[model samples]
Target: MAMGMASSGRRRGNRTRRAAMAEINVTPLVDVMLVLLIIFMVTVTLPAVGVPIELPESRANPVEELPDQVNISVDNAGRIYLENDPVAPGGFADALATIRRNDGEQPVIVLRGDTGLDYGRVMAVMGELNRAGFKSISLVTDGSDTAP
Candidate 1:
C-alpha cells in the first residue's frame, strides 16, 4: 500500500502547475537614490564674490544662501555690478534676459547695496529687477550687536 501511495504522489506532483513570480524588487532603486544623494551633497559649492561693499549693520537675522540665487551688487556711486561684472544701463535688459533664460524659472536675487549708496538708486535697481522677471529680492547686510 505504501509503494502504491508513493507512485500516486509522484504523478500528482509532476502534473501540478505553479504561478510565475511578478513582484518588482526595489533594492536597486534605493541604492541609486542613495548614490545620487551623496553626489549632490559632496558637490555643494560655497558662494564667494570678491566685490567689496560696506554693508549696513542690522539686528535682523541673515538670509540663508541657496545654490541658485543670483548676486547683484550696487556701489556707492550707484553703479550696478551683476555677478562681479559691471552691467551697463543700456544692456541691463539683455543681461537679465540671459540669466532668466538659463534659469528657466521664477528667479531670486540677492542685492548687496553699499551702505553709502542712495536709497533712490537701490529702489530703482529693485524696480528693474522686478521688471526683468526676478520678483524675489533679498538685501544682504551684516548682522551686528551694539558693543562698546
Candidate 2:
C-alpha cells in the first residue's frame, strides 16, 4: 500500500516535468529571423531605376541625388519609361507637363539607357527632355572605382 502511494507521487512529479518542458524553442525562431534579414538585404540592393537595363560604364563622377528626381529609362527595345510607367512616344511631352504641374517645382531628370541601345535613341529622348525645358538632366551609368 505505501509503494502504491509513492508511485502516485512519482507520477505527479513526472507530470510537472512534462509541463516544464513546454518552453518555447528559441532556435527555430532565431533561424526564421535570420532568413528574413537576409531576404531584406538582398531586396534592398536592387536598383531603383524602375526598368532593368544594362547601363554603360563610365568613369565620370556621379551627380548628387535629388529628392524630387524623376527616373527615365530607355530599354533595348527603345521603349521609354517615365518613373517605371510606360509613356507613349507622342504623349511624352504631355506627361512631362503634367509632372511639372503636379509637383509645382522642376524635378531633376535622371536618364538611364541600355548599353546595347543605339546612341541616337538616347539622344532623341534627351532632345525631347530639352524641349520640355528641363534644365536639370543627369545621365546614369555604372561606375567603377578605377577609371579606364
Which one wins on lDDT?
A: 2
Q: Which pairs clash in model 2?
A: none
Instruction: TM-score each candidate.
Output: 0.62, 0.68
Per-residue C-alpha lDDT of model 2 across residues 1-148, encoded as one tens digit per residue:
3555433233553372223355788999999999999999987756776689999998898787766789999999999999989999788888877775335667789999999999899898999999988878899989877767
Tell me the spans in candidate 1 whose CA falls farther than 4 Å from its real position: 1-47, 101-103
Model 1 C-alpha lDDT per residue in residues 1-148, reported as the tens digit of each score: 3555443233454484445657989999999999999999888854456688888888878777877878899888887888989998777767777784344666569899999998998998888888887878888988789732
Instruction: Estimate candidate 1's alpha-carbon lDDT, on a 0 to 1 scale.
Output: 0.79
Query: How far out, in Å, is residue 107 in model 1?
Result: 2.4
Cα deviation at 29, candidate 1, in Å, is: 43
